[model samples]
Target: MNLLDHIASVAALAGRPWHDHAALAADEHLRFEWYRDAVPRDEIAFLRLVLADPDREMAISAVLARIDERARSSIDFHSWADRVEPVCAPVEFLSRRLAEWRLLIDAFAGRPVEDAAVLAASDWAQRKLAAVVDGDLLVLLAEHGRTRRVRALTRVPRPARPVRLSDRAVTSGPIRPCYG
Candidate 1:
């Protein structure tokens, strides 16, 4: 099944109607409580639900808030990883990461900018671009000529060091399995 289908299935399992925006909004309090207390698997599932829906910004903000809370409480990486893995698998994480990178690039693409006033402006832009496109999937896109337009706008020079693909990029296949 595709990601949408997986989302629907997970929402169904959670007794939520994935497509009913008004219903979701009306039940925001309950959703918030669920997010607050959910285990890692459920939390990731809920996050994917929000990310897939149009009300993504609010949902993502809530998730980030919870993450911040957990971090401040001294939740360590091992604990977080134990909760997040297998459900929020590396491939799934990588796909979302790449999507966010593309979104950021697209958001900046249309804005007009003056010529760099100093070397720092160019350097900052290059650094930001490098961070967004750091992983192998993005580098593969660059290699396949998909990034030429973005590179033109960002003027991000390729990294001087060899790019090591993240373990997250080594997926068994697409984030969503194709049933047919």
Candidate 2:
């Protein structure tokens, strides 16, 4: 599937809505123009609702659980990353990180976690991702959880991929002809 469809599928899984083409493009300049052009306006509005709210981490997780359920009832997450460019990394990262944050918040708020439970959670949260899109998302999420206070959760930065030369588009440049 194409990127938008992939994102929609994942969002469908995560139960989070995405932004409309105009709104998404408004927020992020690089959305595929042709794809954006084709999406319906109401869908875009629904997408806007998903993108607009930052307080919906729990809701997003619920959506992801649904997506996971669908996958389990059928197939594995094949091409999971490519299917949801940018969105997958962010959602995956956010979901794991939010869960980690919940633990930390519990700890700080004096809620107790069994030592084994904390270790297991940390291990799961800090595992390195293998896919290109999911690369290090889990680790970063864990790190984010470790570094911040619960009250500062809203201020956490979104996941970012490292710049790779291979991912760049090539453009022509002026060149002089070589002498024979």
Which runs of model 1 end up more than 4 angstroms from their true locations?
Answer: 1-23, 27-30, 40-42, 78-180
> What are the RMSDs of all candidates, in order?
20.1, 19.6
lDDT of model 1, residue 79 = 59
lDDT of 1 by residue, 3-31 (tens): 34544554564665435534444565555
Clashing pairs in 2: 13-63, 13-67, 14-63, 14-64, 15-63, 18-47, 19-47, 19-48, 20-44
**lDDT against the true structure, each candidate:** 0.45, 0.40
In candidate 2, how many Å is residue 175 off? 89
- Which residue runs of candidate 2 sit more than 4 Å off their true CA positions? 1-51, 92-180
Residues 1-180 of candidate 2: C-alpha lDDT, one tens digit per residue: 444464465345344455453454343322333222333333333333343333345335433443344334433333332233344345565445445544444444455544444444543332311111122332343444343432133244546778686786765885458899
